[model samples]
Target chain A: MIETEQLTRCYGSLTAVDSLTLRAEPGQVLGLLGPNGAGKSTAMRMIAGFLAPTSGTARVCGHDVRRNPVAAKKALGYLPEGAPSYGEMTVREFLSFIARVRSVGGDKGYRRFDEVISRLQLEEVLDQPIGMLSKGLRRRVGLAQAILHNPPVLMLDEPTDGLDPNQKHSVRMLIDAMARQRTILISTHLLEEVHALCNRVAIIANGRLLADATPAELERQSRYHGAVSFSAQGSGVSREMLARIPEVASVEVDPLDGRVTVFPREGKPILEEVQTLLRTQNLEVSEIQLERGRLDEVFRHITTSAHPGPAA
Target chain B: MSAVFAIVRRELLSYFVTPVAYVFMVIFLVLAGLLTFYAGDFYDRGLADLQPFFDIHPWLYLVLVPAISMPMWSEERSSGTIELLLSLPVTIAQAMIGKFVAAWLFIGFSLMLTFPIWITVNYLGDPDNGVIFAGYLGSWLMAGCFLAIGACMSAATRSQIVAFILTAAVCFLLLLAGQPQVLDFFQDALPAKMLGALAQLSITRHAAAIARGVLDLRDVTYFVASIVAWLAAGVALVDLKRTR
Candidate 1:
């Protein structure tokens, strides 16, 4: 539903977003992962038609952002960073104002307002001024306004930034439910959020797309060797002997406790051999398990290698 | 057009909901009344027309119009809500015109509240209601000129204080440019035609002519052109800043 061809934004001497080409299909939640100042917000703004890119183009629902901005913006809902709102307006008032501005008028407007209010559970504070609401509640109100028009595409920047864990879960569930029909592009620094919510993750750094794949694919790509961590009785299994075992690349032992972390090279099934060696040495094996690589490790490995870019 | 009206309605509702509109109206009414009656010495002059009342508009609007319009775009920019506004499907011109019309209407509303003064003058004597009506027209048009200036200044900065100060300073210069004291100072250095043109551009000269029950097309065009020029500048500034 959304596509960008070499989309870039430059401010004077600084290139905020550099030739980022990306696409999000219908019913897909594309998680845009990047650290601070990685052009995540700038990229989203370009797609939303708020900020024009210095070069290239961004299109939404087949409409060019710059050429047909109204049509392009009409197809997309954007929750900008910080989710700014008119503090003096009540929750209902703000949503109604946005609804009118978005041209969701007549019965559709009222229906959408009611639907979003209830969907985001903003009915309780609907009458209260938005300035008095907590940050989490205000963020939800921002979400309510963005989704009121039921646009085909949704670009949310840090949707769950300040929410508590439960609120985050509910919001995630909401986005996941909304993804059944709309194309959702979310930019967040939270790695676990991508693993939990998005099907396809795009890791960006230095204004470039470094890795774009499924969470499991990223983990697999980052693994060149596997490690097994186990605990045993403080007895005859010397660290030197464990390192000497066939297929075992290295063994790291804890000095205070009798725990050994064993790294085995690829194509090595050293678990069975290690079990046999423990049995032969008459050492009691307490526990043994394979360590699955995490997405955090993948994120760090990818972003650390990607040079830091200018602030967007 | 509907989008413009929606913004106008929202802006009007905001004014009523906040204390800004009430404070502005009360302050303007009281000041206009005091300046027109006591300060201008209306009874002592014994004029059947509203010339005394209309004469002070340029000075009144120098302060009052900015009080109402300084926050028009500055507050939006300060709160970061300009992003939300610009990102909407509305055109920048529509938004700019919408805000300008809203602030203009507000100043018009406050101007209308001076009806009691008109009633009081009519009750005391046979005042020329035609001149009074024309005077009101002139005052409203002049207020629009000041409001446009305020809108442009508001667009230039995020601080309302700065907007107000800059607008007031520019308007003060515009007002003073027509006075003999300032014109005489420039008389030796500038050509007579240039000095006359500078004074003609001042809102005071044209507004004074309109206040005298004369509906000069030249004065009407001055106010309209002033409003249009500043509003166009405002739209251009907003467009430039949006990209920034």
Candidate 2:
């Protein structure tokens, strides 16, 4: 539903977004992960038709952003960074204004407004001026405005930036619910938000795409891939015997729990041997699990790499 | 267009809902009264007309109109609503024209509220209603020209104070271009033909001529053309800044 071809934007000598070619289909939540000045917001703004690209093309639901901006924007629901709004306007007034402008009104519009207000829990503050609201509430109002028209494509730049923990979880849940029908692109520096919400992640730095892959695929690229840690009950199984297994490369004991964590040799599956020891020796096994590698390490490696990394 | 109307509605709503509209109207009325009564010396002149009242309008608009229009685009830029507004399915030209029209009508509303002075003049003397009506029209058109300049200046910067000062300064230059005392200095520096053309470009000259009840086509076209040109410039500036 969203596509860009060499979507480059430059300001004089500096390029903000460089030759970025990407596509996000329906029902895919693509997390645009990058640090500060990483061109994530710049690229999203171009796709939303707010900023014109110096070169290349951005399309929304098959309409070119530059050639047919109005139509392109009609299919897009954009939440700009910082979640700015008119301070003097009340929440109801602002939402109504946006709904009218977006042509999402009459019975259908009111129903949509009611649904979003209640869903975002904006009922008590509906009549209060937006300037009086806290940062988290303002961000909620911003989210309410974006989804008011039920556009098929959503371009949210740092949607969870200023939200508290509960608000962030609710927003993630809301985005998750909408993901079945919308092509959602959220740009953020939060790696956990990507791990929890995105099916595919694209890492960028210095206006270039660094890595693009599924969360599981990205984890596989980390050194922690296929590692396992287990706990034992009632005089825990010996860590020495567990380390002697052929597939085990490194073994460390958890000082707090007396559990053992094993890093298997490269391309090795050691779960069978660890389980066999429990059955053969009659050891009381409490817990055992396979670990998907940490995304922060993987994100760091790709974004800060000296050379371009592989893309999935 | 509906999109244009939507923008106009939002702008007007903000104007009336905030304190800016009321404060501007009150100050505008007070200044109009002060200019017509004290500076223009309405009773001391003992004239059975509103010539003095009409004469001070250009100067009155010079300062007051910019205050109304200085925040037209500057506020949006400062508050970051410009990005939100531009991202919608509206053209740059449409948003610019819509906002310009709203501010013009707001000035029109405040101008219409000055009808009490017109009524008082009629009761006090046998004033020419035709000339009075023409003066009001001239005032409205001249105010529109100031608003266009203010809007363009406001779009060029994100500071409302800067917008207000720059617009007032530029309008002062435009007004001075028409003055006889100002022209005396230019006569020695430039040729007569060039001086005549410079006088033709003076906003004060056209505004003053129209205020005297002369509905000259040239004056009308000048106001309309300048408004169009300035609004076009405002749109161009907005687009240019978005790329930055």
Candidate 3:
């Protein structure tokens, strides 16, 4: 539902968003992962028509953001970073104002307002002034405003920034429920959020896109280098002996627990072989397990090892 | 049009939800009453007309209008809500005009609260109600002029204090342009016709003409043109800042 062609935004000498071209299809949630000052928010703002790109163009549902901003913006809902809102207005008034501005007319507007309020669980604080609410509740109010028009595209920047654990869980469930109907582009530094909520992930660094892939695919690519841990008690089967195995690259003995951590070569599954060796040596094997690959490890490997180049 | 009306209603409602609007109203009404009754010599001037009441509007608006309008755009910018506002589907022109009209109506409402003074004039003696009505019309138009300038200045800075100061400085210069002392200073430095044209651009001059019960089209056109010019600048500035 949204596409950008070589989009760039430069502020004097510093480029906020480089020639970044990306797309999110309908009913797809694209998680934008980036470090601080990585142009993720700038990219989202360009797509939302809040900031004009210095070069190239962004289109929403096939409408150019610059040439036909009104139509393009009408099809998109944006929740800016920091959850910025009019502090003087009550939550209901603010949502109503956004509904009117978004042109959700007639019974549709009221229906949309009711749907978003209940979806975001903002019915309890609907009449409270926004300035009086906590950060988590205020963020929900911001979310309510964005979805009140039921736009086709939703661009959220750190939608779960300030929420507590329970609130965050509810918000994630809400987002997952809505993902079946709308295109979502979520920008956040939280890696687990991407794994839990997004079907596809785009990693950006220094105004560039480094990698874009599904969460499982990204983890599998990084898992070519894996680690295995097992416990055994036997005579003459030392941790050094385990390290000397052809497939094993390194071994470390836990100082307090005396357990060994084994790093195996790529495409090597030595668990059964190690068990057989223990049996042949008449050793007592305590535990044998494979460490599951995590998205955090992949995120670090992608951002740190990958070269910082212009966005694709 | 619905978007514009939505913005107008929201802005107007905001004024009442906080103490800003109430404080402004109290200050404006008190000062307007005190200036007209005590300073303008309303009862002691030996005139049954409201000339004294209408005469103090230029100076009163020089301060009150800025106080009301300084936070209109500056607060939005400072609080980061400007991003949310610009992201809406409404164009910058619609938002600017909507905010300006809302502030103008607020000032108009405040001015209307001075009706007791109008009543007092009619109760004491026979005065020309047409002239009083014309004076009110002229005052309301001049208030619009001040609000337009204040709106543009508000758009220029994120600091409301700075906006208020800049608006006051510009408005004070406009008010003093046609005064005898200022004209005398410029008479020797510039050509006579150029100086005359500069003086004619002063809001004080046109406001005075209308306050004297003369509804000259040129004076009316001057106020309208001034409002349009400044509000247009406001719209352009909003666009520029949003793009940045």
Worst 10 residues of 2 chain A by lDDT: A231-240
Per residue, candidate 2 scores C-alpha lDDT tens digits across A276-312 of: 8767777777888877788988888888888864465
Listed per prediction, chain B TM-scores read 0.97, 0.97, 0.97
Q: Model 3, range B17-45, lDDT digits (tens) per residue?
A: 98978898899889989998999998898
Candidate 1 lDDT over residue span A13-112, tens digit each: 8888899988999989999998899899989988887787889999999999989998888888889889999898888788878887887899877887
Error of 2 at B79 (Å): 1.3
Best by DockQ: 3
lDDT (Cα, tens digit) per residue for candidate 3, span A92-170: 8998888777778798767877888888888899899999999999998988878888788998999999789988898
- How would you class the docking of model 3? medium
Better of 1 and 3 by DockQ: 3
- Give the docking tier of candidate 2: medium
- Where is model 3 chain A poorest over a 10-residue stretch in terms of lDDT? A303-312
lDDT by residue (tens digit), candidate 2, B1-244:
7778878888888998899999989998999888889898899988767777778888888988889889989999899888799888888999998899999999999999998899888899998898888888887898999999999999999999999999999999999998999999899999999999999999989987876777688888999999999999999999998777
* Global local distance difference test of model 2: 0.89
Candidate 2 off by > 4 Å: A231-243, A252-260, A275-288
Q: What is the lDDT of residue A183 in candidate 3?
A: 93
